[model samples]
Target: MELPEEHSLGAHRRVSEARHTISEILTRSQNEHFAKGNDLDFSYVSSEGGRFRVNVYRKDTGIGATFRSIPSEVPTLEKLALPPIVTKLCDFHQGMVLVTGSTGTGKSTTLAAMIDHLNQTRRLNIISLEDPIEFVHASKNSQVIQRELGTHIPSFAEGVRAAMREDPDVILVGELRDADTISMAMTAAETGHLVLGTLHTTSAVKTIDRVIDALPVEQREQTKSFLAQSLLAVVTQVLVRTPEGHGRRAICELLMMTKAIAKLIQTEQTHQIPSQLQMGRDLGMQLLDQALLAAITARTVDPDDAYTYALEKRAFQKYVTDTTMLSKLDSLAPAAPVPPTNSTD
Candidate 1:
């Protein structure tokens, strides 16, 4: 079958290679079936040092396929270029650590990195429930039981409940998408299991709000209280093109729950949480713009890219400007004169 050529040469070559690999998988196994024919859905490691999640389907007279590339080797914290504050989440023994970002911002990669760290260094039973099983973990000091959503069980919520019975030390849920899944994850954390999950949100405050809003109005208050007690930290990230013009890097905003922050969440005063995060830098908390400014100053990301991802662009702009500009502005402003109203009074 003739496949449509991709626009870029790089993309075309990758697609061609993926197609060849898919064809091989379809023909090699007799037990595999797809679309009531010889087609099959399978995953394999690509020759280019990445993993592929493939779907083979029958089209107008031939077989067509789509492949999603997953990284072959799990990236380290340094390699992923995430903030140092993320490592702090690993210190928590049990609680919900949410890695939140918009789609395609490397949330899955970050989760995999954390799991890989625990798998290699710590002796624990790790249970992972993924939609399509993106990363394949090799058991080291820890044993990993990876359960694909459809292959192992029916849904994420069910898989999570089942994980509790499996006697796991760490549980990784692909996404906390619905209230059922979120509630299950919180329960797992509350029961002394370390729960790690991802969410589709851009800021820590919004992530907290999203979880609360996901529940019914009557349950919202109770849900917030549970979250305040079970939530450990919220890491929000965005990927930006590097200033070096080669690849992308992540800009992360970290929000670690303190007593004050927990009180704010319980009271439904989430807007104040961001300011608390900004003020609590000593506790590994940071606002999104602060991360962007740091990335810009380090030359790891382009100024324009940083500005684009910044939550408060004007504040970030002022932060990135030279001291001379601040000095000039200060000099141009008039000083206040002493008032005679007090003496007259």
Candidate 2:
């Protein structure tokens, strides 16, 4: 059900097809509550042998829906071009790790790979609560229980609360959408589970602020303290078109929650996170601009692609004027830092 983003279909045909698809998905969802709103979100397997997370809503023109394809076979981290350091995340017994980005930037894909890595290597119980389960995993060394919202569960907050009683070693909340859900996910981390979640923000600093802002003013400080203690890493990613124009390359900005970062979160000084990211290179943290520059120098991504998604345009422009500076930037030493350690779960 992967329709072209831009299509020449007539207005009437588009509306008709959209309604039909919505009806089909509703039939599969078997939830009587779908008629309560102007929009509905669900997942359905098409007759054409594709699994998709479907969203149907009322647009100005008429009814419209989007179908995001979910691959039947889960891909590996190396296949997705993720950094090797990502493998280290699986070793953490308990903490919160966030995979963040704008929509369609491969955030879910990255998380799926991480979960799959755990499935292959660890003998732990992994439970994922997704709005509509995508990239279904066949448990390997680990036991995975994936719950779909509206189908298998009521809400993410409820799902996480249920997971606590399920004796889960790892809990993956698809996205921290609201105050209640965020609170529950944080509590899950605080108690004794490794919680992996996603947010819509484009950078690690904003991700921290967004989580705090979602809560009430009175609860923000308490939430920050919880986050400072339980939070582990935040990976912000964006997909840029490859230089060959055949596929997309992911430019990742990784932020490992170190003692300094934890202190910043505890004090609600999130603005300093960008500075920490800049100097925390030895620990594998990098800014989006740095990742973009490295990709450009390596010819994995085009200059235009880098400029289009860069947070600072001037940063990339410097490489354009001075050709020899690329070597200096590439040869920069990584700062020495201790491996990440978290307090009691």
- What TM-score fits each model? 0.78, 0.85
* Each candidate structure's count of clashing pairs: 1, 1
> Across residues 41-123, which tens digit of lDDT does each residue of candidate 1 receive?
55656656677876666555334667777777888887887777787677678889999999889898899899988887789
Report lDDT (CA) for all predictions. 0.82, 0.84
Which regions of candidate 2 fall more than 4 Å away from where they truly are? 1-18, 28-37, 318-345
Pairing residues by index, what is the TM-score of model 2? 0.85
* Model 2 lDDT per residue over 42-159, tens place: 6778899899887776544555567778889898988988877677887899989999999889888899999999999999999999977888899999999999987788999999
Q: Relative to the unseen true structure, what is the C-alpha lDDT of residue 241 in candidate 2, on a scale of 0 to 100?
A: 86
Q: Best-fitting candidate, measured by lDDT? A: 2
- Model 1: pairs clashing at backbone N, Cα or C within 3 Å: 34-39
